[model samples]
Target: MNTRKVYLIWFFLFIFIPLIGSAKIDDSHIRSVVQILIYDNYSKEYISSGSGVSIGGTRVLTNYHVVEDIIKQPSRFLAIICLTQNSQSTPDCSYTAHAYYKYGIAGTSAEYQEELDLAVIYVNNKKDTNGTWKSIADLPMSEFSFDSINPALYGYSMTNIQLGDEIQTLGFPDYGNNTITYSNGVVSNFWMDDGDFFKDHDGVLAIGTSAKISHGSSGGAAFDKDGYLLGITSAEILDGNGSFLSGVIIPITTFNWWWEKVLGYEIIDGVGYTTGSISKEMFCKILYKDYDKLHNTCVCPKGYTENSNQECIAGSTPGSDVKIDNSTSLKIDPQLTNRLKGYILLQVQSQGEAWYVNSVDGKRYYMKDGSTAYEMMRKFALGITNSDLAKIPQQGEDKAYLSALSNLKGKILLQVESHGEAWYVHPKTGIRYYMKDGEAAYALMRYHSLGITNADLDKIPEGIL
Candidate 1:
């Protein structure tokens, strides 16, 4: 007899047999839950581990903090999602994934993550010889029949459930030998976690449940009787002596906000608009670096500023003249004016070639390759004086940089004496994110990417000229 089989027999004889009267949790759903393993290069072992739920396709939804270390030191830290178990008490690392995006950035405070602790990491989906990139939906499973079991299904309720509703949570919590742990309890109550130790601020809404979960259960899913995701298991309340009191679940609606605002996708009626027809309003909302109040238009791309004629142009030094005549205007339609400006447009008709739409001139620049894109970005870099650069601050520093960052909101800055390296000074958080090379710029462009059809893309002229 296998040790795992023996353990399963005893577990069922004690745990599941007694909970027969409670809500039914399908076996497939239990198998669908996966474990997150964080391997540290220096330690040469998995230093930390957490749990996540497969939210269809190749993506696994988990708490942002579960993989925050990977975001900080991506090269040194590797994140692997394990889905199956052979015989050991630990998870089987058969699937490798990349940290796609988290709700917040690396230095964002714990309180902010607590309010919206969500992240989406995905696998390659190419099952080569090693089978490390297989999607959760394509993996083989047992012959267990299910009522509504589709591994790629993502059904969640939009409305909040009432108190006393029975809830069940599934995750690979600690002390359970890495096996999936299922715990059931009624909805205890709900409150808002303002991230204020003194409770002085108002914050996002949270759900409270009496379900039992451990430290490793941070990214698991809380499901209702009908097998819908109620919320994500985020944090637990502990007493003075470290005893478990209650569990805090971040609501599902927060994921909607993150999908649109952070991941650059617009959600409508619970579905996302992912085709080449993304709207101009959504494109500007997510990609704008600043607002040109003089012309009432958006200024985009780090290197360019909007001129008097509402065209994004290079070089707007305090004394330089960028006045353009109205006769030189591109004569673009009123509806499409500045619509695709500042967007990383993909020429879908030509082998997926890339182009960047300058916000000022409304012209497209060919990014023939990564190196060219990087150099082109440096060509229009804004040179700031040492005194002016000193006014801006780094993360964990003073709040004085807030006003400075606001004034230069979304501008790419080059230190007066530095090696011509550029830094993106974030407008909101007052922190500088280093744009190391063209690869980094390409990635950021993809994050800010919006698909454009050939017909619509041709409307904009080509090149910085």
Candidate 2:
């Protein structure tokens, strides 16, 4: 080949090759990078701005300072801007959300030796005008190192990485107008032991990347060559003229350590995302009980009760003592309702989203879930009828008080039902037990008022029990 042709080809490759690589990185991850805009609830004005990375589910991990106002006054005066659309262009921000205080944030403090300036803000569930849910893109799950937090393993292990290994970083730098900003930099320092991010104490390790972390880039992620999140970019040390100098990063290993200490779950290899989908069969097993269909094994039987040998016995019948006359008048479609059938009516009136055969009129009663339904039948059964339901703390009212009641379960005359979760008295001791409302049919819960007497046992022939 001629020297002129060779020079031209090299020049084209030099210019276009980097551009292609940068474009590919942005294309794959721009959606997962979120721009967080905070606001004051009372004044209805904009607060400070920063960036966040979705660890998964509805949770966004950002610097604690980013949502500091929220941590101070949650459910009092705080609002969050959620990017519900593709954030590549102008992010399609949805209806302002002050309702998210319920979901809450974790680790919002300047403590942990200022080492933990991290917070995981939870985005609340909201529906748009079309009744569709507002969704945010989740970052790909990245594993954490379980070996140990050290400079040698993280800073200089990979063949492609060295002491001053070049790294490609992306974040929402306000200088880039809050759009996804890309910067090429190198590993500046590894603070696994003798490092900065602290003045005195030999605190936890941190990463110092030379990436251009501009304003609004706090809590953004730093990725490696293969797009694995290495750490989170927190701050940058600037020169007197306010020019960028060195950036301070919190390694993903730091987060993994904190998460293990606090949340008690491991996130490496995508084991602890919490929101990852599971099959319906597995779903029934994990939260409520244990079940594996392959060997046809479960902790309890199909009827959800154990036999003399402690083995699960399937298809057990309801042992309701009484029966109601003309029960057919109270029958309803079993497909739409979860009420147990053929059980005798227990109360005069019933409430919640279930077909109820009223002992008073013998007519079917249907009410929304969570209201006052099973209070009467429970009263008759255990004398825990009225004010006790009012006194027992409802879920989310006082978590601590209910936690205390758990230890007293045996001492108290508590009747634990599946879905109907009112405090029923222990006909003997009369102590209260906080029953978490569940929907296992074998337990005869109050989620849907299955009347005292089973009227339509045949209507709902099949159940998860």
Candidate 3:
């Protein structure tokens, strides 16, 4: 049945190829776009829905309004990002991503809502069969440069795009949830002032289009000739007679301002991992705490506690006080300095004892021992390589316990254990810790921080035999 739908979609594309007379739509980006499912927490059911595009590794950009309610009360809502299977319309893989960071929609006055209607969401990776964080598919990042000092990143776009130029939009229209829908139209007009397009909009530039944009199309990408991206689909403009006149788009330039102000990094090249995305070593240094990406600092919001795992969660628990090697004060937590300084460095500088190592940027920590370091000592106390530290076969979750201990005793041997963001093993002598760990650790951390009490830690993949 789905095969027929796919065939018919291609057939329509072929039939309209010459008649549409617009920029050639690049189907190569099909994998980059995804359908979003929004669910209200109390009802335990899907309430609203929309579409999104992967802008970075494990990061999706969608309309801030689409997830506005969730941002206000994140504990009451959740979003799932689904990767569509090519042959079928149903999701082949889905990850629960959240609006960990956002901007634009500030005051409560319902006067201007469209000013900065953008948001950044994060997708936690699934553990591979061997318990390593497998790299999930993401959309390619734009190569356009923004700043000379940091470098700007943008998608494909025509130079000095003018009015009346044709556009091809790709997104999951509400009418069709099985496959991505495409529409072609020309830029009919541009709104210089924010509210120029609509009386209720904020002060920002918007493009008016004659394309057929439906309700669920918000947050979808709008591309110009040669498959370069122009802006994101906002909504439709209605005439005084309640008729569809034209579609509206928030220009990519405006989004750049929000991206820089919040994320503090550039996706110079569309593949955003080099600097834009977070890494495993950096994850450990940051300690899985709920942080404001805008300032690139770890911060726990009001009413939430950062567990030993460094995750922000509801309620409170005794301080696990996870260990941090070599740092007299919290001022320069060497554990958290990867992107700027460099990783795994140790030297006797004039300022007493000091060492610096870049510990940020890598895959999420999995039990398979992907070479992330837990502690930087005068010398690695254990001769074992960092990779070997994780090489030991991970144990089952049932055998593990959650505790803060000064010494390793009474805990199950080889059994994985964690308190907050950090996982550890009590070797009957001095304990050893994994900067990150198996699915059990991930679930238990979320179990506390996200209130996912129903999570079955046993189902989490076990790395060790």
- The whole-model C-alpha lDDT of candidate 2 against the native structure comes to 0.43
Q: Name the TM-score of candidate 2.
A: 0.47
Clashing residue pairs in all predictions, respectively, total 4, 18, 26
Stretches of model 1 off by over 4 angstroms after superposition = 1-21, 85-91, 100-115, 125-159, 193-204, 261-263, 267-465
Task: Give the runs in model 3 whose Cα sits over 4 Å from its true position.
Answer: 1-20, 23-27, 85-88, 101-114, 125-159, 194-204, 261-263, 271-465
For candidate 3, the lDDT comes to 0.43
Ordered from best to worst lDDT, the candidate numbers read 1, 3, 2
lDDT value for model 1:
0.54
Q: What's the lDDT for residue 204 in model 1?
A: 40
RMSD of 3: 19.0
Cα lDDT computed for each candidate against the true fold: 0.54, 0.43, 0.43
- Those runs of model 2 whose alpha carbons end farther than 4 Å from true positions after fitting are 1-23, 76-88, 95-114, 130-161, 194-204, 271-465
The digit string of per-residue lDDT tens for model 2 on 1-465 reads: 000000000011111112113323544355455666666656676656766665543446677666666655765444344442233566544523322222221111211112367666655434456866432111111211001111112332233444455556656666776566777676766555554432222344655666677667776767766566666778776665756666767766656544433332334334311223223344234223355556433344223344453322223444322223545222233232223221222343433235333221112334223332333233212212133344444444542344433322221112211122334322123244353332222133343222443334333322221
Q: Residue 42 in candidate 3 has what lDDT? A: 88
lDDT of 1 by residue, 167-280 (tens): 788877776677777888767666644554212122345677778777778788788666666667877776657666677776665564444332323332323211112222
